[model samples]
Structure formats: structure tokens, C-alpha cells
Target chain A: MKVTDEILNRFIDGELNSEELKEFKDELNNSRDVQTQLRALQAASVSFKNIKEDSPAVDFTSKLMLSLHKKFKSRRRDSIFIASVASIFVVISLLIIVYILAQIISAAGPNSSFQPGLQVADIFEKIAQTFVSKFSSSSVSIVGTIISFGVIVSGYFYFDFLKSTRSN
Target chain B: MIKLTDSEIIESIKRGNQSDYSILVDRYKNKAYSLLKRMLKNNMEAEEVLQDSFLKAFQALSNFKGEAKFSTWFYRIVYNTALTRLSTKKRKIEMEMSSIDDYEFLKSGFDIHSNEKEDTAKMVNELINRLPEKNAAVVSMFYLDEMSCEEISNVMNLNVTNIKVLLYRSRNILRDMIVQNNLVEELR
Candidate 1:
């Protein structure tokens, strides 16, 4: 049987089955041409292996470790940065909601000077008076304030929950 | 007392144990460098690619689920990094040489000689390096690293059959090159 290039390739790549392997080995032993082909392929593979393995750079492990350290540190720093930014955003959003609620509450309280006897001083006074009057007369503002506060607190808690879950 | 696994080392690094990454890098550095050196055919570029590969691996360590062996994942990174660098360099050279005439002129100056092989082993390297980069990669991965065709398929993003065919063809190419160059006699 002739050893085609395909068979020789399969033999070289170790893709041969038991039967094929036996045949290949028999051929290699019996035929000088097959033996020559196998030897050349094996030698070429060995040379490539040696060139790669014998690179001159010394302390490659240490250098790689140094670069890995820098990379890990930078990645960690980036994660921390992103986490801090997200936390700041949450904090800022909470603060803004809280501040808006505080202003609404101060304007809506019973002692709000926007009652019938109170003076409407200027545009600021008129705006404040209008805001107080709306809140005092209607239950909608109170409900809205409660829901908004609930939403803000829930958002904060939810963000914290998400952060903890992600960390885990 | 504990012998840390590669995944464990990666987890430690992800959890901010920067020092533990040294073990991971130390474990894979030489192999990665060797892969890059064979792929790029230049020491400086190979070293740079090796560093970049390790750095990329460290950065993406969190995503590594250990589905494959750590070395396989590391080798994939090294292979990609080296290929990317080579392509970029090739593109830059092409850009610098505008016309076909310019490219031919540049190519004439570039001496792509097979190194003098002192022995069978050296002749093998010469032939492997003389192969096209893709074929060389397949040959190296199959022969030098001893990776399974399936694993190489995953690493190279080719079908298993494709990798098998590539390995087959690449070995034949090397065999032919060696015979043509009269290196088989040298091997004997």
C-alpha cells in the first residue's frame, strides 16, 4: 500500500487509529522513503520546539508577574472607581430627593406663613405661598411626599442590595 | 500549607490579593513567551506580546470560569496578542510603502533567510519558522504544546475538523519542506 501525503500527515499528527498506526509503523520500518518523510517531519517539529523554548529573555516569570501586578492593580482601581462613582450618584440622588422633600415639608407645615393672614411679600413669597396653599388644601401633596420619600429610601436600599449582591 | 490552583490564584487576584498573581504569572510566563516568540518570530515583539497577554488575562480573570485549563486560556490570550501585534505591524509597513513597486523594493531589502541548522533539531525549527504563520501556529500548538485538536479548536476558534485538517496539512508542509531542503538526510 502506498503511503499518501494524507496518511503521512495523519501519522505525524498522531491521528492514526490502532490499525493505521500499525500500518504506519510497518511502513516506516520497511520503506526508507516513508522513514525519511517521518524523520524530516519529526526533526522540523523538534527544531521549532527548541527555538521557542530557548528564548534568551531571562527572568521572564518575574517580568510577567510585575506586569500582571500592575494590570491587576489598575483593574482593581478601575472597579473601585466605578463603584465609588455609582455610590456617589446614589448619594447625590438621595440628597436631592431629601432636599426637595424638606423644602416641600417646610412649606406645607401648619405654621406655614401662607395662611389667610400671612403677607405675600414678593415673587418668592407668592411662589412659597402658592406651594403651601396647594399642599395644605390637598391631600395629594402629602401622599406624593410620602411616596417620593418611600421611593428615595427604597432606591437607596435597592442600590445597596444590588452592590452587595454583585460583591458576592 | 495550601497549594493554590490556577483558578484559586485568579480568584485571589480578583479579590484584591495582588501578590498571589505572581504565582499565576510565574506558572505561565515561559510558555506564553515561547508561544509568542514562535508566532511573531522576533524576541522584542514576542516579549511585548507576552506581557500584554498576561496583563489582558489578569484583567479578564474574573470572567475566566475555568471551563478550560488555565494554560489553555493563557495560550489563547498569548496567541491573540501576538497575532494582533503582527497584523498591526504588517499594516503599518504596508501603509509606509504605498505602491506595489514600493512594497517590492522593501521586500527586496528584507532578507528572509532560513537560519543555518547545526543539527536535526535546528533544521526542524528552521522549517517550522519558514511555514506561514497560521500553519506554524497549528504545528506548534499540535506538536509542541501537545494540545488536543478539540482544545486547539476552541483556542483558535475553528471547528475541530478544521483543526484536524490544519494539523494534518501543516505537518505535511513541514515534511515536504524538510525533504526539499535535504534536512531529512541531516536528521539521519
Candidate 2:
């Protein structure tokens, strides 16, 4: 019978029945190759079993926990900071867009007489109205836009971080 | 007073009991560190990989389905982490070796009468380290960590049969190396 890997592994593991063991021993006695293979297996096992276990340096756990905590905290803080910065940018952009639109509307209005007193009053009223209306609408739009973009960008960064981290 | 299982510890971590994660870390860190040390053969790299593995395990703990033992799952993370480090280092060394001769060079000085057993063990360890990365991993997991073939299979994502075959092949290779080095005499 051909000495199959399954049989050899079982022999190595000492998992054969008494009769199977007898047959295997007889086969081993007849086959030089089988005897050499068995000896090699035994020697390898002996060498492997002799490997020594080395302990990690003292304070490994404490330092690891501290570092993990700091990493988690930094990641959380970075995400929050990015979101806040993005929100601020969106708010500023909306405010600038609103201020320009108000200026364009006021300059295009029918009250274009440039008499000093009336011009000053009209300009004041226009400035106040623009501030009030634009502040309200821009606040809503800026907050909405900021939230959406912030979420998308933060999500992308988070996933990228996770992917890179996993591979490392 | 209630006892906690690995699953329970994981659940507690998911519920925001972040401190409970230390239990999980404490449980697997040493084993992970040991495996990395053998795989990378560098203490600093092993420690970094160990920390990275634990951080990963903690982050992904919620997704753990209890299909495998927690140690097995954690080992997979550690194994992958160490393999990446080894591969990167291997690439750097391969580039450097292009300029050097292919043949082995003698050390500046040799101790002619080193203790035979100690020399043998050192030679054996070197040969084990020289095995294909996968085989080295299998031998390290099996022999160094005292893990069973099934556990190795889980960590390695291989079938148990494949693990058995790999283990057999690796043992044969190691034996051949030992005999070639004259560490052990061939049986007559």
C-alpha cells in the first residue's frame, strides 16, 4: 500500500489503532524511506518542542492601554475638529453668498435717486434688512449644507482610516 | 455576582464599558506579542504589532460573531499585522541583497567549540525562521504558542486538513535542515 499523507499524519500524531499501528510498524521496517521520514518527523517535533517562550517587557500592558486610549481619543478629536472646521467653512461661504446677493438686490432697486439724506437712509435700511433676512436664511442653509458635507467627508476619512489600519 | 464569558466581555465593551476592554486586551496581548516576536524577530516591531492588533480587535469587537474563539479571532489580527511588517522588511532586504553575493559568508570570528546542544538549537531556530512564511507561521503557532491545529486553522483561515498537511510538510523541511546541518544524525 502507498504510504499516504493521511496515514503518515495519523502515525505522527500517534492516533492509529493497535492493529493499524502494528501494520504501520511492519511497513516502516520494510521501507527505508518511511523510516527516514518518520525519524525526520520525530526530530522536527523535538526541536520545535524545545523552543523557549519569551515574555514581553514589563509595563507592556500598561503602555499599550495608554497608547490605545490616546489613539482613540485623538481619532475622535480629529473627527470632531474636521466637522467643526467644515461647518465653519460652509457657514462662512453661505454668509458671503448672502451678503453679495443682498448688495446686488439693493443696487438694482427702483430707489436709485442719489440725494445725500435719502441715499444715506436707504443705505442704512438696506444694510439692516439684508443682515436680518440673510442671517436667517443663510444660517439654515449653511447648517444643512455643512452637516451633509461634513458627514460625507468624515465618513470617507473614517472608512479610509479603517481600511489602512486593518491592512497594517 | 455574575461570571463573564469572552462574549460577555465583548458585549460589555459594545455597551460602552470601555474599561472592560482591558479584560480582552489582557487575555490575548501576551499570546499576540509572542507570536509577533517569533514572526518578526524584533522586539519593538512585535510590541507595535501587538498594540495595533489589540486596537483592531477592540474596534472590531462588535462585529465578532462568536463563530470562533476570541483568542483565535485575535490571533488572526495579530498574524496579519506581523505578516505585513515582515513582508515590508523582506522587500527592503531583497533590494539590499541584490548587491551582495548569493553565497553564505563566514562571520568575522567563529567559536569552534560552542556547546553542541545550544548550537543545535540556534541552528534549528534559524532554519525554522528560514522556512516559507506560512510554514514558519504554522510551526510558530503550533510549537511556540502551543496551539492546536484547529486553532491554527482558524487563525490562518485554512481548512484543518490543509493545516495538517502544512504542518507535516514543515516538519519534514525542518528535519531535513537539521540533518543537513549535522545537528541530528540520520537514522540508519
Candidate 3:
């Protein structure tokens, strides 16, 4: 039998069927070349399996954990930074959108022919008049209430931050 | 400490329990390290590659679809990391090995018996490392980890036929090396 290397490889890997395996075994028994090749393959496999000293360092996991911890922290910081930037951009965009809408409504309201070349002083005077007229008694009370609410919210967050920092 | 399956551990990690990832690190460290060590043949490089692969695996966990076993996927990363490092160092083997006939391996004068497995095994550390990285990887994955050809194919990103061919080539090369060194008799 003109055995090929591929066939021998398959034989060693047990990829051959019973008949082929039996035939190969008979040939192996008869052939010193087959025996030598098989021994070489077997030795390589056995050596790797018997290589008990190829294990990792005992502190390997600990070291990996440390690196992983730093990675996780770095990832978290990046996420937080991205989120914060996105939130700031969203807030700024919303403010710009609201301001643009307000300007459109204001320009469209009383001054039907509001021109672009209006003086800065005239623009400020118009804005001041509008604010003063809009700030009636009920509006003033509403503003007071909003200011009080803002103070309480800020105070709550400030105290919370102080408490957390102190505990730390 | 209770044992959890890889999927379960992954689920826990997904639930914001990052510390649970240490379990995976602990589980795969040795095998990953050994494979890297065998491939790179450097302790510091092996350790660096091991750590890098683990970090990469953890970061890419969300991309893992569980189509393959976690070990295969993770080992693939380890293998790739080692490959990249070797390539960067320009020490990667570029073999133009010709067709090795079956009879070529069969003409060996060395008569190594399987009973001398220990003697043969002793020569493997030095002998196996001399193999080209690709064949060395295939051999280690096949014999050391007992990975199936399909799994090795998945990890190595090669088809099953190619992996089989690598295996054939690796076995022949190792056998040839043994004959050249006359270690077959020494190991006898």
C-alpha cells in the first residue's frame, strides 16, 4: 500500500474508518517507516500533554484582574465624559432652539415690519418694556416661587454633595 | 465560591456586575498564558499578550454572540494577539514548505516506541517551539487543549480542511525534526 502522509495523518487522528484503520494498523505493524512517523507524532502530542510546567504564574489572575480593573475604570470615565458632553450639547441646543423660537414669535408679534438694522438701544428698550409689562403681580409671585424652588433644589444637592464628600 | 457557566457569568457582567469578570479572567488565564508562552516563547511577551487578550475579550464581550463556545472565541483573541505581536517583531516564519509525501515521513530510521512517551514528551518543549507559528498553534490547540478541528478552525479562522492540512504538516515536521536530531533513539 502506497500510504500517503495525509492518510497517515488521518490515521493518527482517528479520522479513518474501521477498515482503513485496521488496514493501516496492519501496514504500521509491517512498516518501520510508519512506526517511526507514528512515534514522532505520538511523542509530540504526549510531550505537550505531559508538559505540567507550562502553567501560568500563580498571581496571573490577580495581575489580569488589576489590569481589567484599570480598563473598566478607564472605560467608565470615557463613557461618563461622552455622556456629559452629549448632555451639555443637548442642553445648549435646546436653549438655542428655544431662543430662536422666542425671537421668531417676538419679531412676528407687534412689529410687523421689524427690520434687521434696528439699533442695539432700541432693541434693549423694547425687551425691557416687554419684560416689565409681562412681570405683573401674579408673574412676580410665580417668579418668587420659582426662585424659592431653585434655592431649595440647589441647597438639597449642595448638602447631598457635602454629606457624600464628608463620608468619603 | 459557586461555579457559574460562561453564559451566566456573562449575563451577570452585563447586569453591571463588573467584578464578576474576574471569574473569567481566573478561568482562562492559565490556558491562555500557556498558549501565548508556547507561541511567543517569551515570558514577558506571553504575560503581556495574555493580559491584552483578556482585556480585549472583556471589552468585546458585547460583540460575542455565543455562536461559538466562549473558550473558542476567547482563545481566538489570544491567538490573534500572539500573531500580531510576532508579526510586529518581524520574527514570524514565512515557510515555503513543499509537498511532503507520506513515504517521506515513513523512511525514518528512528524507531520510537509509544512506551517511551515520557522520553519523547521531554523533547517536545524545545522541538515544538521550533515549528512555524501557524503549525505550532494548530498542534498546541489540537493536542494540548484537545480542541476539535472545527473549534480550531473557528479560533484560527481557517477552514476545517486547512486546519487538517496544518495538522498533517505539523505532525510530519515534528517527526522529521525528531529523525534529524536522532532524538527518537535517545527518547527510546
Candidate 4:
């Protein structure tokens, strides 16, 4: 039998057939390389097998679970915080736009005659009438646009939810 | 309490039973911790990285395809995490493979070694820890975890043949350590 390192290793580990094993044993007595390899293998395996397994610290599980819980909770909190910030931003932008438009309207004083004795109610009624008439003409298109945007956003979220579920 | 397969538990975890993840943590923490400690060679660092690996695994659990065994998959993550952590310290490790050829053979094969050699035997695992990363990992997995080379190949992402070769080289290195340290009692 032609003995090689891998073959010799297998023989030491009892992996060879009986016929080959005998041939290797016969060769071992004469070959320094084979004998040396076998001794080395034996020493390594015998020592390694004797070492004990180590268990983690007693608080290992609790510590891991606590960390995981904190991570999950923190992620939830981050998403909520982002959503809150976004809504606050939208509300603030709307308030700023209303303020600007109100300033523009006030800058362009009511085109009606300022009868010095005109009641405050009469001026309020006039402003309300002009505001509705100005926007009422395109209300249908504006409502259509808002409804289309709502449908698209909802559809996008629904599809996203579907994709996540399907992947899971 | 019915025993649930890992994949089944994984399915439930994906279905929103997040707490079920604790079962996996409980099951694999020892193994994961042990391997990490072997790789990192530090208990506190191993504990921290172990948590990171588990947390990352849980976060990415949705992507698990259930094709490989869960342990294999999870261990891959742990291995990669250690690999990343090791990269930071890789430059600092000065390997002393200087006297490899000086290894002596046991006289006419192994002799009547006794409990007296227990100290050197004890240093065997420590010697293993000092091997190069891939070699050390293969040795730890094969010996400590009692895993097959095939399973280790999956975890380490190396082919079985290559792993075996590395394992053999690692054994020789270990053998040389045992000899070079003059731990063996005698040549007879």
C-alpha cells in the first residue's frame, strides 16, 4: 500500500479497510515519516478530547433577552417618533401657508366700500362669500385630486403589506 | 409542552410571536457563546458579540428561507460577526510559526503517558486557541462542539476537503506545540 499523509491520517483514525490497515502497519515499523505522523495524531487527538465544554454565564439568557427586548422596543419607538415628527411638520407647514395667504388677503383690502358704520358681521360675511366662490369653481377637480392621492397612498401601503406577508 | 422543530418555531416567530425567539436564544446561546469565546478569546467581548449576533439574526429572521438547518444558518451569522470583529484586531496578532520543522516524533509512537502529563494535556485547548483563525475555528468546531466536518463547512463556508486539510495542519501544529513545549515526558 502506498501511504500518504492523508491516508496515514485516516489509518490512524481507523478509516482504512483491514487489508490496507495491515499494509500500513507493516510500513509504519520501517518508515520514520509514518511513525512520526501517527504519534503526532495520537497526541493531538488524545489531548483535545479531554478538554471540557464551557457553559455561558448564569445570566446569559436573561441578558440576551433583555438586549433583544430593548432593541425591539427602541425600533418601535424610532418609527413612532418619526411619524410624530412628520405629522407635526405637516401641521406646521399648513399653519404657515394659512398665515401667508391671510397676510396676502389682508394686504389687499376688501374691494367693497368701507361704510364707516358697517357691522363686523357684514365684513365677515363678504369675505366668506368671496372665498367660497373663488375656490368652489375648481372644487370638483380638487376633490378628485385629493381622492386619487388618498387611493394611491392606501394602495401603495396595502401592496407593501402584501409583499411583506408573502415574503414571510 | 409539545416539542417544536426549529423551523416551526421560526414560523411562529415570523407570524408575530416575537417572544418565541427566546427559545432559540436559550437553545443556541451556549454554543454561540462558546464559539465566539474561542474566536475572540475574551469572555466579555464574546458575550457582547453573542447578543449582537442573536439580535441581528432575529431582525433578519424574515429573510431565512428555511433551506439550511437553523443552527447552520445561525452559526454562519455568529461566525461572520466574529470574523468582522476579528478583522479589527487582525493586525495585532503576531503568529509564531517560527519553529515548525523542529517538531520531534514520539519514540516508536506514543509511550506510557500518565495523569502526570495532565498539565500539558490541559494546555492542548489553549494551544488550539492560539492557532490561526480558520484553523482554530475548525478545531474548536470539530472537537468541542463535536460537529462533523460537513456541518463545520456549512458554518465556516469552506469546503469539506479544505477544512479537513486545515484540520490536519492544525493537528500537526498542535502536536508540535505539545512536543516543542517539552511537555511530553520521554522519548520512550
RMSD of each: 10.9, 10.6, 10.5, 13.0
Better of 1 and 2 by lDDT: 2
Local distance difference test, per candidate?
Answer: 0.67, 0.72, 0.74, 0.73
Q: What is the RMSD, in Å, between candidate 4 and the native fold over all Cα?
A: 13.0
Note the DockQ of each predicted structure.
Answer: 0.27, 0.30, 0.32, 0.28
Error of 1 at A104 (Å): 3.4
Docking class of 1: acceptable
Clashes of each: 3, 0, 2, 0
Candidate 1 vs 2: which has more DockQ? 2
| Native contact fraction per model | 0.45, 0.52, 0.55, 0.52
Better of 3 and 4 by lDDT: 3
- lDDT of each residue in B1-188, candidate 1, tens digit only: 88888877887877878778778776666666656666677778878777778778777888899898988888888877777887787843543344322222222222223544454455456545544555567767776677788888878888988777766665555555566666665544
The CAPRI classification for model 3 reads as acceptable
Which residue pairs collide in model 1, if any? A44-B124, A47-B125, A48-B125
Cα distance off (Å), candidate 4, residue A80: 1.2
* Per-residue lDDT value at A98 in model 3: 76
Give one digit per residue, the lDDT tens place, for model 2 in B1-188: 76588998988888888888877777666766667766676778888888888888878887899988887888898888877776777753653353212213211122314545557676656655555556667888888778898899988889988888767776666665555555555321
True contacts kept of 3: 0.55
Residue B94's C-alpha lDDT in candidate 2? Answer: 52
Could you give the DockQ of candidate 1? 0.27
Query: What ordering of candidates by DockQ runs from best to worst?
Result: 3, 2, 4, 1
On lDDT, the leading prediction is 3
